[model samples]
Target: MASNDMIVAIAGGSGFIGAAIARRLAHAGHLVRILTRNPDRVRDRFDFPNVDLFRADVTDPSSLRIPLAGAHAIIDTVQFDGYPVENHRRGLTFERIDFGGTNALLDACDDQRIQRFIYVSGAAADAYSPHPGFRAKGNAERSIRNSGLPFTIFRPSLVYGPGDRVLTMFARILKLSPVFVMPGSGQQKLQPVLVNDLAQCVELALGGRGLNGSFEIGGPDPLTFDALIKLMMEVTKRHRAVVHAPAALMNITGAIAESLPHPIFSRDAATFVLADSLCDNSALLAEFGITLTPASIGLRYLAEGS
Candidate 1:
């Protein structure tokens, strides 16, 4: 840990955005503790001298209090991977991890006297529905809001960078499927922000002296879902035929995919993608006193980082 530095703990710090935030804060001379379920899995990933890795699960509130006790700030970047988040004991859905786990984290936060809280929410969370993932995110936001903790809620558009699952998944599909499937005419507007920009927002929130509020952030330019796919094709130089998946058919496919052990696409994801994920980042830009990086600029990092 750095000398006399404020402690900053990040959940899910092993992943793309989390790792980026951890590294950036560490560079800024803060003591960063990364909490994750699989400590060994991420052991060698982060080499920052100021970062400490600890094993923890968001589902268990008891496991969090110790780490969060004296932290100056905390970031919630927890994600429930795969389509179905099965809960044998309570038949819980993905919402359990989203809302339940977040509430648990908040409860742990309640035990501490932190100055700032940063919750990394998605752009689609603006109009969430009963869909497992969507509802879970919405519930998480509500839980944080209800917690009354001084916090910053960041709803970023599809985040992509060197080590992003979003772009990587699209790349995978493009490589596998000869006909790229886009949902609902692919006209839904999406503003894809860079992981660095989102992390910077978190950093700014932390430095803003408990400004404690919510902000919607997006990329430099708006692109339709189909246009995004086309851009992806252009970037990776893939010429796969683009296939537009009707919403009805996508629902069926998503259902079938959900039944599988690990389905790449969720029906809820398709539905959210059908809706506009574009957000105005003017507030975030003003607060940070910096211009947001373009998603396309991050794509260069993806090419090299991959």
Candidate 2:
């Protein structure tokens, strides 16, 4: 318990993004505490000198106040995935973790006298989004805004890194396929933000109080969904059975894929991805003083993990 050093607590810190943020902060000589449901799972991950571990589920506020105690800052990396699966470490619905969890975390932070609160949110979430997933995150951001705490809301475009689900999925497919079947025309644009750069932004967000506002962050460039697949193929040195399935064909394929394991195309995933997911990274560069690595460079980091 180094009281002199800044003590930081992170919610959902064992996952991919959170792990990166925790590791980066820990390496920067910060006393890091990560709140997770399974301490055993993250024990080895956070075995670094400056990092600590706490077993606290976001769905349960009873244990939150204790872990957040004495922390100077809190970084919430919780990404509530709606996919139904056991051993997900969280059993609550997306609404429960996304909205309710923020309130509980904020209350705990306030109780702990936390100096800064940084929330990692997706770009799709906003003041107006018809999608339930986006709406939940929007509500959570609003909750943080109303909590009277110094908060910085980060709306990062599709984050991809070594262990990111997005890039790994494409890499796996590209390794196996000679041709890829993309949704509709595969012309939808997406800005894949690098995880390391995102983690750096989070670190910067914690260092000072100036970045205490909402900002959307993305990569240096936007690429089409099909273009990304080709890049993955190039990196993997594998050619894919490239197919640009028509929307009707994708609909039929999605129906069958949805019923199977690790489908190549899901209607929900396709809808969000095939639609434009763009954002201005200027806020991350100007306000946060962090410029994100390009997608091509970031993909290299991911492909190396394989």
Candidate 3:
């Protein structure tokens, strides 16, 4: 598990968080394999030595075998993107991607004898959570924990960086409108973590230090949703009036809009945003020796190409 001998297979490595992890590991001189359904689409995105983009799909257990083979460890960053109902209609949802896919990956890990597993989950993941996605993520976490493999689970809150969907969407909205909609009271807390920092933490875990159990990872400081929006606006050099909407109203609106081809927000995401996404990152800080990156510095990336 030394950095020099690391052959890490990353599921969903074409994604924002997974790609960051791939870059970090590749920079550390590890043989990085990015497993995805469409390898050609993501292959050119990585130019580092010892980096390979291989075709694999998490939901198809058979497709995972070749990519995951001969790897020292595997990192699961796979997540279903669309709304629950929409995704379900397309045969892709948290139940399939998060829960079923995770279980499939775990089975492959066992067959391959890859003991070190790193799962990038969510901060609000809970088995009993009202949000179906969160509950499905919780099911995945349970599978990882119970797999009897040495594992490190990182539940990051609102990860943002350049090209990130959430922050990028916010920047786009700020550019188009004079007024920004604050989903809820704008007082719900969030501890947004920088994508690079989270990647670094995963790299540390890949090196076989503190590679067990779960860790709730977040930024240096927790701020209200409104404060985060203000910081984004300032960094992006945009002036906009922030208006708050009730959580109930926003959820109702999101539910109606969820059937759209691309929804600004889904009912599940809106409901989760109403609650606090804060967590004590003392373990993430001390165990991984990560100096968490603050949003003030990291949100600058969101301004890029904007």
Candidate 4:
């Protein structure tokens, strides 16, 4: 680590968004320690000069010792992936990772005297939201706010990039399916931001621009679900028939699938995609002096990475 550089510990540093932040911060000369249950796996995913991998499972608060040690700030990008919100499987779920894990990290930060905390939440996060995932995110946000720590909570809408699973799923669907299926009239508004742009916002929070409050982050242009699929088709040079159905149909199907050991879609996924994810980034621009990325150009990476 450089003499003047500060050490930043990322709770989920090996994840898609967390890896981007780790790369950006490491390139900027900050020592970034990646805290995850599987440090060996993280090493396989990402490697950089100023980046170090440490074993720390947020669900197991005792494992956070090495990762949080001697850290100046903590960037929490930990979240539960996959469908159906499994609360018991490996003790990983929206409630476990988002709410419980966040509480654990906050307590650890307090113990370590960490100066700053940057949390990456979703655009539709609300404590009272009907969706479990969104509600968990909201609960996490509330915990961070009440922790009495200097913090910045960023709620980004539909973050996408080269290795993003959503876009990759779209590509896979277009390649395999006879017809492209879109839920809820394909009109749900989404302001998809690039993962890099969101990472930059986290970097800004570390630099002290966004502190003590929350900010909404999104792309320059907002697109509907149908338009986003069309754009993906255009990017991948795949021309397929498109079909639309009521969002209720997806929910019903997902509800049935939730009973299975592994489900392709969950009711939570249906509700999450059906909800509007639009956000105004004027505040982000004015406050941080950062320009948002356009969805059209941002989707280009999908083609190259595909």
Segments of candidate 2 deviating more than 4 angstroms? 1-4, 81-92, 245-270, 302-306
- Candidate 1 stretches with Cα past 4 Å from truth are 1-4, 83-92, 126-128, 175-178, 261-266
- lDDT, candidate 4, 1-306, per-residue tens: 332287999988888889889998999888889987788866977656998899898888888876898899899998665633553445657888888988999988766777789999888889998788889999999999999999999999988886777878888898888799888898889999999999888887788788797999998898999899999888888878998878779889978877877666777878877889988787888889887878778888767755
Which pairs clash in the backbone of model 1? none
RMSD of 4: 1.9
Better of 1 and 3 by lDDT: 3
Instruction: Candidate 3: list runs displaced more than 4 Å.
Output: 83-86, 259-265
Q: What are the per-residue Cα lDDT tens digits for candidate 1 across 255-278?
A: 776666645656675676577888
Per-residue lDDT value at 238 in model 2: 74
Error of 4 at 274 (Å): 1.0
Write down the lDDT that model 1 would get.
Answer: 0.77
Of candidates 2 and 1, the better by lDDT: 1
How badly does each model clash, as a count of residue pairs? 0, 9, 0, 0
lDDT of 3 at 276: 89
lDDT of 3 by residue, 14-75 (tens): 99889988888888899999998888877778977879988989878889888888988999
| Per-residue C-alpha lDDT of model 2 across residues 1-306, encoded as one tens digit per residue | 342368889898988889999888888888889889889866987667888889997788898988888889888887555332111234444467777788889877755676788898878886477655577788999988888888898888788887677678777767666666676787888888888988887777777734568888888888888788777777767776777768766556656776764444455544555567788877566787766787667777645654
**Cα displacement (Å) at residue 260, model 2:** 10
Off by over 4 Å in 4: 1-4, 83-90
